[model samples]
Target: MDDQQVGAAAPLAPTERTDYAAADSRRLKIILAGEAAMLVAAVLVVFVLKIVTGTGAIAIFAAIVTINALIMTWHVRVITNRGQHQARQAPGGK
Candidate 1:
């Protein structure tokens, strides 16, 4: 194989891989935290301030919950992918 091809095929060192995974986990955590904060703020706006009422309020909450669910779904996929990558890099992995 050419040098470029060989380099492309090489796996990341354990430290680099760990650093990447750690960064990804941290980012996901930050995103989830932000989502939580936003949901709390929405609650305050809808219920405490009474800015929205009845169906409108319900719709707002539903939208926020749906967005949160989508983010959680993506988060799970990222975690699963990371686990699979780690397993593939382990000794005796096929």
Candidate 2:
């Protein structure tokens, strides 16, 4: 086999792979939207709590928000891992 044949037979670099680009873009959009929605929900929850329970409730509300943020982060991690696994298994994927 010639050098040209060997080069042509080489696998594409991970960055050069396009099999999952579209799906990855969609997943990224979903994650971003989900995170934004979560933030909005947290703010609304805190606002409601304050309105009904006064400033003294802020600490509890903040704690709840923190827990929710942690959960959201975990969800993002799951989404990323699943995407990476799928990409690795796809034809011509990294």
Candidate 3:
């Protein structure tokens, strides 16, 4: 065999563990779910406030919550992509 083949590293055992794509995927799912929950909470808050107090500013609050949700959704996607990219570029990322 050539030097390259002879010097190749052996594969890991069946019991070996590594943190990579699975962790990232889990984190992404959590982030997405959390954002969705927040959106639902915001909507609930708007309805509750409206029913309990009949406030005229309900629309404003709802608008704010929707804007917040949109912004946060964008932010989470950006962060998730950035983390994945950085992880890939990190030394021994796999």
Model number with the top TM-score: 1
Write down the TM-score of every candidate: 0.62, 0.56, 0.53
Off by over 4 Å in 1: 1-7, 48-55, 79-94
- The worst-scoring run of ten residues by lDDT in candidate 3 lies at 10-19
For residues 1-94, write the lDDT of model 1, one tens digit per residue.
Answer: 4434544546657776678778777877887888788778877776743444445777766777788778778887887687677758644444
* Winner by lDDT between candidate 3 and candidate 1: 1
Clashing pairs in 1: none
C-alpha RMSD by candidate, in order? 3.9, 6.8, 7.0
How far out, in Å, is residue 58 in model 1? 2.2
Estimate, for each residue in 1-94, the C-alpha lDDT of model 2 and write its tens digit: 6434544545445654454566667777787787778778878887888888787667876786787778778877876787776667554557
Return the clash pairs for model 2, or none: none
Candidate 2 weakest lDDT stretch, 10 residues:
2-11
Worst 10 residues of 1 by lDDT: 1-10
